[model samples]
Target: MAKTVVITGGVSGMGLSASKLFLSKGWNVMIADFNKELGEKVYKELSSKYSKKQVAFQQTDVSNATSVTDLKTKTSQLFGKVDSVINNAGIFTKGALHEVAEDAWDRIMAIDVKSVYLMTKAFVPDMIEQKAGTIVNTASISGLTGDYNMAAYNAAKGALVNLVRAMALDYGKYGIRVNNINPGPTMTPMFKANPQSVIDTFKKASPLGKLAEPDDIARVMYFLASDESNPITGENIPVSAGFEIYSGQPVQK
Candidate 1:
């Protein structure tokens, strides 16, 4: 029987790539995202490429505990049991620390951090019962370091890094693995949505001479989710293309 995997925010960006990779590897994929249109589109596209039984979608608002619970229930009903979960739903709230709105900070934290808690709570019981499972959280470089005009996003992602470690330590005895992937300046809808000048400036800052693509992060996720990384847990794997190692430098001309 094919292993079942659940991915939140699986309709776009790195989440979408992870979903496709798992499906290609013969895993049955259940993708959850807030955008019903994109969710349906991805499901249809994958279904056309693979069998309909190999792919599924559930409209989910990961920020809502009830919605996440419903997602888990529905996934179990369709796939019997989940073998892995990728907590990849997240958002960026752009604002400086002092000027950031209370509501914006709360909202970002709820989606980026609280969603992980809710998703883990909802799925870990089944994992414990089965005595095997993996959980991968999509954190960011901002989580490991500070960023300008990203107060809420930075804080939430930073919390996620530690949360992954704590989960790994607590659940290791149960045969459950928890880890985090921190990508730097990935080329995703969110990055493209930024002003062109801002994107250009960011690209020049990276030591690698360019921003990361979604596939760069997705490949790391695959390793963490697969048996190839079976002995690795409670770790933060930085997929930043050496951006983290670069010192302050003039923009590439």
Candidate 2:
């Protein structure tokens, strides 16, 4: 039987890129995102190329249990079983700890950190029963280190990284592998919001001398989701193009 994958926040950005890669590999894909317009748009685009039965979408608020439960049910109904899950749904916040408000902190944790818990709670049971599956969480380089003025985003991602580790340890015995993909500043909708100078600075800082494209990240995710990586678990792998070699290394004046 062909494989099936459930991708959260799969309507746009790196998630959308991952969706395309999985579909190209002949996998049934069920995408869940909060953006109804983008979700419908992606559904139409993919369904045009692949069978509608092989692609489905749900407008889901990942932070909500009800929405997550519905997503789980719909995915199972459409594809029968989920062999892989990409917990790529998240938001970024820019602010120092003192500057961020309680509401912003709550929202950051909800979408970035808590959603992982909710998703795992909803989906891992079947994987356990089947004794097989892969879970890939989108963490960040910032989670390992820290970025200026991004305390909330840093904290949430850091939590997600460790959560992947802890869960992998707990579930690996059941043939469920959990790992994290730590992407650097990628050229996604989220990073495109940066000013030209900011983008230039980041490009200069990167060892590759350019920001990553979404496919650059998706390809790594695809590998992790495949059986070739069955031996890998609890690994927080970085796809940062050597950004961590030393971020913002002195630029020529």
TM-score of candidate 2 on Cα atoms, chains taken together: 0.96
The residue ranges of model 2 lying beyond 4 angstroms of the native Cα positions read: 247-253
Best by TM-score: 2
lDDT of each: 0.91, 0.93
lDDT assessment of candidate 2: 0.93
State residue 117's C-alpha deviation in candidate 1, in Å.
0.6
Check candidate 2 and list the clashing pairs: none
The sequence of per-residue lDDT tens digits that candidate 1 reaches over residues 82-111 is 989999999888888888889988889899
Residue-wise C-alpha lDDT for candidate 2, range 170-238, written one tens digit per residue = 999999999999999899987899899999998987767998899999999999999988799999999
Using alpha carbons, what is the TM-score of model 1? 0.94
